[model samples]
Target: MYFTFLGTGAGVPAKLRNTASMVLTMPEYQGDAWMFDCGEATQHQILHTSVKLSKIKKIFITHLHGDHIYGLPGVLGSRSFQGGDDQLTVFGPKGIKDFIEMSLSISSTYLKYPLEIIEIDEDGVIYEDKYFKVSAKELEHGITCYGYRIEEKDQPGTLLVDRLKAEGIMPGPIYREFKEKAAVTLPNGRTLNSSDYIGPDKKGRKIAVLGDTRICQAAVDLAEGVDVLIHESTFSHGMEEKAYDYFHSTSSQAAQTAKAANAAALILTHISSRFQEDDHLLLEEAREIFSPVYLAKDFWTYKID
Candidate 1:
């Protein structure tokens, strides 16, 4: 799976940044993209990438702040015009259903596909499929907000084509059986154990995306052992007082959470505009606590293997 940063600025748009939006793309699904937060000008950001608007099947909103959800109606309308016919499921906090419906109604924008809106309130699994499961946990934002954990499902072992060929078992439906079960017997009275020919199944990656909030114990629990922790760091270490006053987290605090969670990497996003021209200090401050801490910029793309 690959994660593409669409926007990284906090609260408002800036000359170099939009707002909070991220795209999770997987190779198994054709052009399928899962968006995290559709902030203002999200549609415009898509124009610069290979991402197709019609392939967006799911959208997860972290909160109701204008910077997080102001672009939903436009994206929905654009998808309809772009010939998207599949059902779309949106998960968010309360008032999302009314907000989307009211906005679409007032704007006279109609969709050509089914739309499912789920209002989340607590920590639990919100979405599940054969490939992955997404869970949410409440955070300490001044208003209600959520942090999401996307855990990819365990996959099957790879088929050993060379071993099959050596055993005179030509490729056919038998390979599928061997991949799924313990063994496959050939017409020659020969039995092949799957474990002897197939490679070990690789563990799936886990990603945690934290929304606007202060440093809290719940955040640490949600991010435990994550491959990547996308947490908001809205202030520098020296601004701890201001961060607490505003119910936001400083760079060090976000790094500490990642360290506590034993995360392999941390991407610090939702940057304040005050240091638009100077992100090095913020990144350095965070790196002091977590060596793999990254400062996300608009349009940044990363692939996790």
Candidate 2:
């Protein structure tokens, strides 16, 4: 799995950043990519990267803020023209449905694919399949916002072909039967247990992506033990007062949240345009509290380990 930042700026587009958007690529893990947010000109940003709009199966909106959703109508309409006819589901806060419906209705934009909008009002598992489970929780933001926790299901253990070969078992249809059943009877009347021929199960990775918010416990709950934590750092250190007054967070606050949750790595995004020329200041501040912190730039990609 991996992540591609489409727009890393906050509020408006800057010379180096756009707004707020992210694409989590999970082709090998889940066979498709999922978008975390779709900020202004996000569709335009996708054009500069390897992201495939057709492969975006689901979109999780953090809030109804314009910077986080202005490109939805354009992206949806373009997806249809690009031959993306598969179903696309969107999960967001209440009123997201109205905003999308009204925008599309007013602009006369149409999508050729089926669209599913799920408005969330509580915290719980919002989406689940055999491969992954997605949960959301409310965060302290200017408006009602959410953070998502993506937990991948544990994968089956590796089949020990070397062990079978040691027992004189050659590559044949029996290998297929061995994987499908717990125990299999060989042609020679011998019985084999699949458990004995399988390695330990590999635990799946966890990722937490939080929308714009101040330091809050809900953020900790959603980010606990996550492999990666994507948080907003709209300000620099020593600006905690201003950060809290505006319901945003500083680099130090973001780092504290990651440190508290024991996140393996922290990615800071939604950078304020005020730091347009000094984003390194924010990056440096976060590193003081949490090592391996990254300041997301537009089109930057991060591999999820």
Candidate 3:
């Protein structure tokens, strides 16, 4: 899996950064990518990257804020022009469905693919499949915003080739049956349980991505023990009061949440445009409270290990 930040500026677009937008690409999902918070000029930012508009299968809107969703309509419309025929699903807070529908209708934009919009009314599991599960929790923001926790399902263990060989089972097409079926019958008429020849299961990865918010327990809960915690750092350390008044988090506050949640790593994004040259101050503040913290930049991609 890899996280590519298309834009990371807060509130408005800047010369150095656009607005809030990122793509989570999963190799297991083929060419499909999941987008989070498509702000203004997001489609334009995608133009500078290798991410294809037609490959975006899902969009998760953090809030109804213009800075977080202004580019959504454009992105949705452009996907049609880019030959996107696969079904696309969008998950967001209440009123999101109305906003998308109104924009598309008013602009007379028709999609070539099936569109599914799910407005979240409560916090809990919003999406689940055989490979992964996604849950949401309300956060402390000026408006109703949410943080998402994505957990990949545990993978089955590898086939124990050495054990099978010890049992006189040579490598052959029958080895495939041992891995897929509960039991495999040998040529000698002996049936062997597949479980006995498999190693321990592999633990799956977890990631938490939060919208704009103040320091809150819900943020920590959503990020608990996650492999990566992507939190908004809209202000510097000394601007705690200003950050609280604006219903946004400071760099230190974001790090505090990460430390409290015991997150393996932290990626600070949604940077304010005011600190054009002093953005490093935010990174320094976060590192004081949490280790392995990163400041996201536009077009920068981070691979999840």
Candidate 4:
């Protein structure tokens, strides 16, 4: 899994940054990619990377802000013309479906594939499958904004190769059966239990993506123990007043949420355009409060080992 910042600036575009947009890549899912906040001209940002429109199976919008969703129609429309045939599922706060439907309807744009939109509310599991589960929580934004928690499902225990070999089991279809917990009879007329040969279950990775909001306990709880946290730092510490006035978060505030959550790493994004001249300073401010802090930038990609 990895994250690529397609755009990091908030509200308005700057010379250095576009708007809010990020791509979460899951290599194990056949290069499946999920996007968070498709700001204006987001498809153009994908031009600089290897991200394919076809690979983007899901999109999560933080709010209904123009900067967060202006690029949705264009991206969705272009994908149909660009040979994308897979289903696209979009999850966001309420009014998301209406917005997408109106946009495509007004423009008379037809989609070549299935387009599904799920309006999010409250703090609970929004999506789940054999591979991953996505949850959402309400934030302290002035309006109805949400924070998302994406957790990979715990994987089955690793097969014990040594034990299998000791039992005279070679790597074959039988090994798959054993992994699947299918009953297998050993040469000695003894049944080998799958649980006995399977190691401990591997914990899945967790990532928290928060929308624009003030410092709130709900944010911390939603992001608890996340392997990576992508939080918005729309203002610097000294600009706390402005952040509060605008229902945004300061660098230190975002760091505090990550600290309380014990997140392994923090990627500060949705930066206010006001700090364009001193983007590094904004990053430094958050780093002072949190050790493993990264200020997101346009087209910046971070891979998780």
Predicted structure with the largest lDDT when compared to the true one: 3
lDDT (10s digit) by residue, model 4, range 84-122: 999999999989999999999999999999999998866
Model 1 / residue 177 / CA error / Å: 2.0
- Candidate 2 has which clashing residue pairs, if any? none
What local lDDT score does residue 17 receive in model 4, on the 0 to 100 scale?
93
Compose the digit string of candidate 3's lDDT tens values, residues 248-287.
9999999999999999999999999998799999999999
RMSD of 2: 1.2
Candidate 2 lDDT over 1-305, as tens digits, reads 88999999999899999999999998685459999889889999999999999999999999999999999888888888899999999999999999889988998888989999999999999999998999999999999999999999998888899999998999999888877899988889999888998888889999999999999999999999999999999988999999899899999999999999999999999999999888999999899999889989999999987
Ordered by lDDT, highest first, the candidates read 3, 2, 1, 4
Q: How far is candidate 4 from the true structure (C-alpha RMSD, Å)?
A: 1.5
Candidate 3 global CA lDDT score: 0.95
Q: Which candidate would rank higher by lDDT, 2 or 4?
A: 2
Q: Which segments of model 4 are wrong by more than 4 Å?
A: none
Off by over 4 Å in 2: 29-31
Quote model 3's TM-score.
0.96
